[model samples]
Target: MEEIFDECWNSKGIQVFVKRDDLIHPIISGNKWRKLKNYIQTFSLNEHSGILSFGGAYSNHLFALAFVGHSLRIPTVGIVRGEELIITSNPYLNQMNDWGMRLHFVARSLYRDKEIPSEYENYLCIPEGGYGSQAIDGMDNLVHELPSCDAIYCAIGTGATAIGIARATSVLVTGILTLNNRAEIEDHLKDFPAANLKLDDKYIFGKYAKSNADLETFCRDFYEKHQIAIEPIYTGRMFYALVDHIKNGHIAPDSKLVAIHTGGIK
Candidate 1:
């Protein structure tokens, strides 16, 4: 937990701190570790053949999973979305393949339905982007890792991290939506009726994984100022929204905000 001094928030009399989950590790850092912690803990080789998960060609989740599988000496399978993508499509995919994760490319049509191949029925299949009850349960400890603050900020991917933090704390949890998944996120929040979570999609900047010049500029400027790395996809939109809110007087004065740097900087 590090307190960040920025003129936008400072001028408004709001204290801003960033929970640097990105520094948790070089590979399995940030919410990747948080979301997968329980899945790894509950897995037993005797009970299950291996772990299977879904992702795209450059999925950070799959990359981290592959590393975890290699480190734990557990068999792992990754059902890649694009059938055209292969093990050598990109360096990230190549690294995941090198880590010994069986890369099974599936048709985009079938991947949409999240159909698990019949041969891996025995494997424990984590949902795409690690968004499931287990992943949400895995993030239960996020609140304990924070300093006292009035609000918590985090980028919503599977909605697990923000919801997990909201469930664990009474403070306001503001999730900046990086994509157009408000309904999906709301569905995930149904199980947690008392969660103090708010979803903001204003800063999506068109769609997920899409970056424009302004976003790139903010991310670059943010790094120059704070010396903390944040990519435009996840953490960038989050901090951008946080700064915008403070600058527009949306955040109350004297409010202490903690932003979770959920680590997408590969």
Candidate 2:
């Protein structure tokens, strides 16, 4: 896996590094691999009929799981959180379909009640963004494999990896929230035992998967300058917030900040 340190080096004064978890496992790179590691290991491919998970149309978790299941010769199902619609030959969805993942659509209203759904009986109910206890269990290995650093930063969607990372290390964990659903995220993290996890909701462009011109420009220029592809969903926001924090003197010069590159470079 190529670790593009160039993106972090542009801070002028701040010394930043990115833990390229996105490159750890090819198709299953980043947090999705961490979140699904245990789940994948526990069952034999022949034991279960298929693996089922939830996601939005463009979800990296869904894409990763589809690839993993297909490679392992396991049937997969995706409960997409939207109204049923025809899927075109877009790169991401096309790849998932090529991998033979059965895509199912649910009403956005029904998706909000995911936890108590009666449809989850036979399927392994992996939540959206791969949150919950299983994901935290898998993410426990993320920071432990890295060198000691002053702070570890990542973008927060479901808040599972942040909680797990903070719990697994003494380093300060700062999460940039991509969702306006901070209070809801906080409520979800109540059971997790992470000591130094902090959430910043200000960097969220508007809502999940949404971005503004500043972010778009930053992503384009950052990729052009460093040749590292970053999608707006997670890594882009983390990169933006990290640079802004350094520029604003929020990060100390002596601090060794490591950002988790949970990659989905679309």
Candidate number of the best TM-score: 1
Backbone clashes in model 2, listed as residue pairs: none
Which candidate should be chosen as best, given lDDT against the real structure?
1
TM-score of each: 0.97, 0.89
- Model 1, range 1-266, lDDT digits (tens) per residue? 88889877787789999888898899988999889988999999898899999998878899889999999999999999898987889998999889999999989999999888899999999988887777777777778878888998999988888888888888999999989999988887787653589889999999888868999999999999999999999999999999999888889999999999998544
State residue 221's C-alpha deviation in candidate 1, in Å. 0.5
lDDT of 2 by residue, 27-83 (tens): 778887898888888866456567888888788899999998888887888877777
Give candidate 1 misplaced runs (Cα > 4 Å): none
lDDT of 2 at 59: 83
Backbone clash count for every predicted candidate, in the order shown: 0, 0
Task: Estimate the lDDT of model 2.
Answer: 0.79
